[model samples]
Target: MDTCYGTPNRKIVLLTCNVDDMTGEEIGFAREIMMKSGAMEFYTIPVQMKKSRPGFEIRVVSKPGDADNMAALLLKHTSTFGVRMQELSAYALERRSQVIHTPFGDVRRVIGEGYGVLKEKLENDDVCAYAEKAGVDRKTAERQIYALLEAEKQER
Candidate 1:
């Protein structure tokens, strides 16, 4: 992929296809396959197709180098006969991961900063582990962890 000089981070490719014959489970499996094939984004949009049949328009974004593999996976895993690909430049935030210490356990937090703003979130796997160990739901565990972080900020 060519380096983009604009606000976007880099150049990428978008692959799209339309299909209506796959079941929900099949779509899920196709999504997993595309993700494993290094697709940066895999999503579907519902559309009304010919003869009033409902179908899904699958869209996948990938690095230019991975577009061929992503397209191949989509062709192999989905009900579509052909895939369309387009090159695009995309914006992305700078991101990093940190281990957050809590009373229950250590959680991996993903921190993103860019364009004069910053955001943080605990990794889902870590949150799930924390929830199980602390005997709380995921949302509750997240709240508690954020509360602890806020308290720590207040102290310092």
Candidate 2:
């Protein structure tokens, strides 16, 4: 998974590939691989090629500090031998917090309150533990957390 790193937390790296015309299925597979490699963004915008033929712009986004990780993934998944990379400075939500209440404990996830929106933040592990201890369905717990987050959004 993509971890947050870099000073000021501008950790988004984009890798672009300009390969020969590729099929939609191939593009989809490439996207899947990119996401699995922890790419935050995987897109293929359509573009006109030579003779007006159709082509795509394959791009993968990762943490700026993860430049090496993104490049390795690009080299492994795409047909291109090299991927162009660029570093960008952006202001993202400072960060979100997850409270890991060990078995049978209550977790009060304090979503970033200063950000544009405020809500409860429950990660997959949180839901799993809640379900395992509370005897609730994992999906149900996920929905519950989503509901809480949504309610908090409305309050903000």
Q: Pick the candidate with the highest TM-score.
A: 1
41-118, model 2: which lDDT tens digit per residue? 888877776687777668887887677887887677676767899877655665676654344555556465433444
Instruction: Give per-residue lDDT, candidate 2, residue 27.
Output: 73
| Residue 18 in candidate 1, Cα distance off native in Å | 0.1
Backbone clash total for model 1 is: 0
Query: Per-residue alpha-carbon lDDT of model 1 for 18-73, expressed as tens digits?
Result: 99889999999999888877888899999998889999999999999998888889
Please list the C-alpha lDDT of all candidates, in the order they appear. Answer: 0.89, 0.70
* C-alpha TM-score for every candidate: 0.86, 0.56
Off by over 4 Å in 2: 1-9, 97-156
Off by over 4 Å in 1: 1-6, 151-156
Task: Give the clashing residue pairs of candidate 1, or none.
Answer: none
